[model samples]
Target: MDEIIRQRIRNSKTLLGPFPNFFYEKTPDYPQALFLEWFQVAVESSVHEPHSMTISTIDQHGSPDSRVLILKDIDNEGWYFASSSQSAKGKQIEINSKVALNFYWSEIGRQVRIRGNAVTMNKERSSKDFLERGKIAKAIALLEKQSLILQDPHELEEALTKQLIKLNRNPKLISPSWTLYKVEATEVEFWQADKERKHIRLQYNLRGEKWVKNLLWP
Candidate 1:
């Protein structure tokens, strides 16, 4: 590992700080509302790719995999994103509905962690979402074989060309197995940046089918 990583690890082993910024936490009963406020702020600010989040999943062999994916939708129910059912993350969700999602806006030094159960939306809904995408996205979707092996780059390019030609002929055709899945959070954590080292952390938990809030250490 790098020397900087080693140094950071050593620093983490100790508690040292001037500690002060838990004061920005929002008022009672609306943790999600606070998240919305921060998200809106991020959108209006200069932070690039604010919608990108780390999607954590476990493979069939139990190894955890995490990669950044753009957020597609958000509502009171949860966050949504679409993928091919054959993709590794998609397959993992099918095998185990439980997963974690993390959003970190480093420019603003804010982060959100969500633990939830994923539910695949209906086929029609998935198709509608796919159809609504831009032409380049649609073309790329038709080309990339998510999580599948590609032996030859030229072969893959040829396949993409063929698919594009087909797409040009009839743009209405939707991938038979495309899917949109939503991660319905049972727990959510909101963390805000600190001027001093303290930072602000708030967590919401689903207890007996109801959401309960609690403060947490930074």
Candidate 2:
């Protein structure tokens, strides 16, 4: 059985791309601009969850943890995402602000990796972000006990019901722990896969308010 599974894994094909000719493409001076261009392509290509990305954080014990999250916004400041301050990832961010974000669009055979420091936005911005969420999402945020052991499933249902009721009464009620975080990227790498085993990797490094771009060996 193990041999069969191993063979299946070994035979799996990857990096098959009718990929863009990024090798000859002119890249922007800023990583953000290039990222937006690639993101627009992904959206037009109908890539599933194009805004979804993996955010990796370092825990208190110095172990790396990662989870998929939807991208909230992006600007010159950096990439934005939201979460509860009391959640595991939030606590980890408090301990160590450094983080990495990865976005993969398999259909396009492209990926973007970012290493940066995450900082909490001001309370006004955070509250605005919270209010923009759907009622169900707002209710879940109000629960505020994320990553805690749920000994009783019924308790969650009851808690969610209560929060929904509260929302109905006061629509403006927002979770105090809900926070918006922005990642200020120091390094960003863009990778494009080729069918012929030659992949293109371009990296941008932040250097004293300037961005330096270089090609990397695949």
Highest-TM-score candidate:
2
Per-residue error (Å), model 1, residue 217: 1.4
* Cα lDDT of model 1 by residue, 17-83, tens digit: 2222334544545456666777887786666888889989888888888888878888777889888
TM-score, per-candidate, Cα-based: 0.86, 0.96
Q: What's the TM for model 1? A: 0.86
lDDT of each: 0.79, 0.94
User: Candidate 2: minimum summed lDDT over ten consecutive residues — where?
Assistant: 16-25
lDDT of residue 20 for candidate 2? 69
Candidate 2 backbone clash number: 0
Alpha-carbon runs more than 4 Å astray in model 2: 1-6, 23-25
Instruction: Give the lDDT of residue 32 in candidate 1.
Output: 63
True-vs-predicted CA distance for residue 127, candidate 1, Å: 0.5
Alpha-carbon runs more than 4 Å astray in model 1: 1-25, 28-30
Q: Residue 151 of model 1: what lDDT?
A: 91
